[model samples]
Target: MAKIKYSPEEKKTLKSMFWNSGLVFAGFNMVKMEGNAFALTMSPALEELYPDVEERKKALVRHNGFFNTHAVMFSLIAGITYALEKEKQTKGSVDDDTIENIKAALMGPTAGIGDAFFFNCLRIIAAGVGIGLCSTGNVLGVLLFILLYGMTQIAARWYLLRMGYSFGTSFIDTVFESGLMAALTKSAAIVGLTMVGAMVAGMVNVNLAWTIKVGKTSVVVLDVINSIMPGILSIALVFGLVALIKKGVKPVKLVFGILFITIVLAFFGIF
Candidate 1:
């Protein structure tokens, strides 16, 4: 919404990227979750910015590195990257590392915002209305959900994508002028970690069912544990799994190990 105008070629490239951003999940993998989709989305921009075939190929390879975020942020990052790429090609200011670092810094915070807003709030509202309609035998509920949640996502993605492109240059310049790149990165990282901690606190639960009897009294072991430190078990369990993961433990093995441990604990009345 700036007092700005795009050239015909810029419009064409952005249009291409807007459509390509929707395929963010295509060919997703653990090693590079959305890297393929990201590369595809940046194709048009890279093609335009780097006319040389070899440079464009290198740009593609560079963009295809371990990108993952919510769909909305995916488009936003692609737009921002497009801006960064243009700067790199034109001003010789932003380098490949700067582009990558900016993407990395934005990914976490954008993911937390996107997921919470879309998945938790908008999706739930849509589902609530949709379910009510469906229960009444009206098919409009399902259609409404799609129209409400899906179309909103599309519109928002387009808007934010353009916003990123329009404002990214100024934002980057401000960061450079203020020498706030490191501070910005660290702050974004803190927000990202806070979001992760909130998720862990909400989702991970250690429901202890252990009990013991002494004389005529029965005591709940979980209560005693909680008295010592509330949610300590759950925190420990989550961190323990995370540690195992960092140690290169395979996910399948981790799942099976958890199951086996659960079964043993249940048998011992310590579930």
Candidate 2:
């Protein structure tokens, strides 16, 4: 069977749609999550492919179901979905259930991998570099970060969209067989953890100024703690916060709690 080819203009249009409308309507509901934005992103392609009002409506409705994933990584899924829809339109071989099933199966893994790699690793690395530069009072640091991160995302969207369309279902099998996805996920996670650790070590400060007088010798509390284990207090604080989070403490409450503690400690000369 001859494969359908999208015009350059159509490809450009789809890319624009995915980039612009990806997260515009993101929300949580009982019916669907991110469904409205997903449908909106694909509306142009659906309209172009299915000229019949009923057919277009069906396509739109088919996509307007529970859909949640990393907002950017979903572009790859969108591309594959568009290709599958086109195939269904032209060949009538693929079914709606297959399409929905593929989306449901892929969204979770894609989101997990995407969040670990892009959000935790790439974003943190970019922010670290940008912030370091910004501390020097250079405005270019902010621009550099925006440009670097934005361009990478845009390029990934464009490339993944094209790759998904070109390979369709075969791409999934190819990725699994090659083991590239797993390797990437693992490597990104390691790097992300290392970077996060570095950030915590540099950013978190816990010092004790109190001293104990023993036999006319003043021993600094912070110095003793440092001698025993540097950054132990900081590490403990981080773990404490993590435990609180795991215990269902709301983030806003945690923020205010930290603020209150800091204020009280500073006022009492205990920090």
Candidate 3:
């Protein structure tokens, strides 16, 4: 990574990207959450890639799709996308689907790592120390939280963003040079799907309280299900929603369906 050198123009573009990426929460929406910030962060690179007016607009629209991830991972993926877009313009090895698929694949795993480290570990430690200080009437508590948690995340985002660009470019170039582009794409999709399944198992919960009366005993349905295979129901629910979404179902309807089903299940003493 240290061997990678950037021209002055490249340095300026990356500097602008690092600053723009800090506005990760800007123009957030259900359809394209974080996309506006992603486009903003990628703008400097995109401008350098696509000099023509119409082509630039098309490239911007292509990137402004639904993208969601932890803010730290968001910068990383943005950096990778910049590299992919550059590849698309220069070598013509990476196409639209390849870029989009790679983005989708990287987001989940990177997000899980980022959240576990930053949100779960760092945030708790920072808050605990900050709370301890504030309780002792030290104004430094609030500032400490900002310094430990906030500033740390900002710095991490910047580092990961640059690393993503440098590493992604080198990695993509290697794959192309070795004629393993398709293999790598397939591998990435496999890993992405595996991560999604793992997330569903860890995060999704089906709180089953139903019991069946056997001849002389009561057997808990959830326990029986778990015995057969743990979290199968959660996996099913997640994949089912994914299938529906692929079939063009809107997210709002799915949310309402989940709410309705949960309410009905709760009323019947199952959730």
Whole-model Cα lDDT per candidate? 0.85, 0.73, 0.85
Model 1's TM-score against the true structure: 0.68
Which pairs in model 1 have colliding backbones?
none
Rank the models by lDDT, top first.
Answer: 3, 1, 2
Worst 10 residues of 3 by lDDT: 191-200
Tens digit per residue, CA lDDT, model 1, 1-271 = 3445889998999999999988888778755689899999999999899989999999998888667789887888888889999988988877787677678777777899999999999999999999999999999999999999999999998988888898886786787789987776566566656655665687678898988999999999899999999889888987897799789887568778888999999999899
Deviating ranges (above 4 Å) for candidate 2: 1-5, 24-31, 169-271
Q: In model 3, which residue pairs have backbone atoms overlapping below 3 Å?
A: none
- If candidate 3 were superposed on the true structure by all CA atoms, what would the RMSD be? 4.1
Report the lDDT tens digits of candidate 3 across residue range 1-271. Answer: 5347888887888889999988889778755678788888889998999999899998887787767789988888888888899899998988887887788788787888989999999999999999999999999999999999999999998888888889888988788889999998787777766765665677679889898889989999999998999888887887898899889998779888998999999899876
TM-score, candidate 3, is 0.73
- Higher-TM-score candidate of 2 and 3: 3
TM-scores of the candidates in the order shown: 0.68, 0.58, 0.73
lDDT per residue (tens digit) for residues 164-239 in model 2: 6667745534655687755534554555456556646976788766778899898888988989999999999878
lDDT measured at residue 235 in model 2 versus the true structure, 0 to 100: 93
